[model samples]
Target chain A: MREILRLIVVLSLICGISAGALTVARLNLASRIEKQSDFYVRGPALERLFGKPAEELLGNKISLPIGDHLYPIFYLTEGSEITELAVEAPGPGGYGGDIIVMIGLDLRENRMVGMEIIQHSETPGVGSRVEKASFRKQWQGLPVDEPVELTSQGGQIDAISGATYSSKAVVNGTNHIIDLIRRHRDDIMAVIKAKGE
Target chain B: MTLKQALVHGLWEDLPPFRLVLGLCPALAVTSSAENGLGMGLAATFVLVFSNMFISVLRKVIPDKVRIGSFIVVIATLVVLVEMIMKAYFFPLSQQLGIFIPLIVVNCIILGRAEAFASRNPVLLSMADGLSVGIGFTISLAVLGSIREILGAGTWFGWQVFGASFEPFEFMVKAPGAFICLGIILGLMNAYSRMRGETFIQT
Candidate 1:
């Protein structure tokens, strides 16, 4: 009986120590993320640039609903007669996993300004090349109307040498966003105008 | 029983992945790149060392009935702590590892060592066991990662190793290649052991 009690006590002590340590670690992680977000503007800088307060530009705390996906839209009023909408899209499964891409679109010009890979788990030397500036720069100013094709298909953009699948995934994801933007042009424009009013 | 025996055992006799086949999930998942393999190896080593020490200290007092459950809870807490720290300081590595970071809670090697060695040993001995096993696992992962990275991408540590004319094998970087490469390596290990007059258990 004494042995049993001793065991119980020891187990409880270990559990208690672990719980306390985890609580402190979790708090530290949260604070670090908050600090990093502050440096990156937390998706509000683009909104504030359009002459509207951050909160107003982002709308309600809940993101605006788009077909099947909730997209956070930021309104910018640079008075260049062009409305740019940033969209986050998920690429089909790559060698690593689905790649998350952030795309910038110029609605008036019907072209892409830039595309950035937010996250990917692709192999370091192979699939990671998809995130290289040289690879991504190929998509800049690509017209929305034209099909995005790989160099293998005789298109202008060159695919990463060993990451054909991942490169295709990114191209497909970007094309999907372009199609969505074209379909919702009127509603997107309305949101932009609503911010101005 | 001796420190030399403990160190040597980990390299072959009790290898975490090959002999025991523990921690196979992370062994397969995060070994896509040499960098990722290095990161995971170090993280797992940290968990293994601390968990073994704590488990050894409490082994005498812990009841056998619920020992496994108790060990899991302790290990899970350590895994979460590691995940949190990695995310805070090594953001890129944390992102690269993704779900596998949290999944370390379920890795079998740490639990296996706790049950097989630590539970019956003194704290100091357990620490040594942990260190040896961790080193063995790290070496295995680095070897596998180097092979995959070099052949699949024609690069070594992100530098071009092969001439410009060398076309990398596209299939090698895929999930299928992970299995094939692991199988080949295991066969080679077995063959080498046999040639050295060592008995290889087909586990």
Candidate 2:
């Protein structure tokens, strides 16, 4: 009986120490880790879309109120002036869950620069094929005003051969972005203006 | 066993999945790609080394009846620590590894080592055991991963090893493929050991 008490005390002490140490490490490294993930994973994708270093894009980042949330917004600059907008438009529910994406738009609002899948839980081979350049290429230079949908549904985009649901999720996300852009156009412009001052 | 023997046994004789036939779950689950296999192996190695070291250090105080529970707590703590560190620093690899990192807590190699070696040995020897076993596991996973990735995806480490004309045998990356590949590897190892006139396990 005494042995059990001793064992419990010792084990509790060990657990307490381990948890305490982990708490300290978490507190110390949480922010730095977030920054690293943003730089490593999201950095390359954003760079590919904007043709600018991720660091440069990060400098102009500001979160703007859209609907109920403050969505991340980046003002892409040509030289000294903000010429385009890169908004993080997390789309509605996907085949797996919410498909988060970044959509870049030219200042003239004529064409979408590009779009990149930021985070997704789609299946590896079938649904995950949506991340391939072939599927995403169809979105580049596409007019924002044009309704985005799979070709089978009377739209320009081609749904991935075996991953129609996943493809539709991306298209749905694109439409969500379009809606956000249309509704928040004036507010986005004002946010840009405020940043310039 | 000598220090060198302790350090080297896991490389082949006591090697996991093939010889000891332990921790086969992750071996089959994550070996679809060379990258994932290596990631899972290294993560296991990290957990194994720390748990072995800590367990050895605390062996004297831990009661025999509650030792398994104690070992589990220590192992779980280390696993969580590894998960947090991996998520913070190596976020992409961490995501790729996903649940396997946490699953290291139950890896038979780790618990088996603590019960068999770490509890009886000094810290240095336990550390050596951990490193050797880890390297052995990593090597095994890497070979398995290479086989699967090459045949399944027609690629090596995501690079195209086979020409575009080559049709990949996609079955090599699926669940059945994992079973088939591990079975073949185990068979080959047994055959090779028999030919060498050496017992697969010392016992």
| Alpha-carbon TM-score of each model against the true structure | 0.63, 0.70
Against the true structure, whose TM-score is highest? 2
Q: Please give, for residues A26-63, the per-residue lDDT of candidate 2 as tens digits.
A: 89878777677677767777798889888877777777
Model 2 over residues B1-203: C-alpha lDDT tens digits? Answer: 78899899999899987888899989999999999999889988988888999999999998887899889989998888888888787888887876677788999989999999999999999999999999899999999999999999999999999889999999998999999999999888888888888965433
- Separately for all candidates shown, the number of backbone clashes (residues 3 or more apart, or on different chains) is 2, 0
Lowest lDDT block of 10, candidate 1 chain A: A42-51
After superposition, candidate 2 runs with Cα above 4 Å error: A44-56, A63-197, B87-91, B200-203
Name the top DockQ candidate.
2
Task: Give the clash count for model 1.
Answer: 2
TM-score of chain A of each: 0.65, 0.79
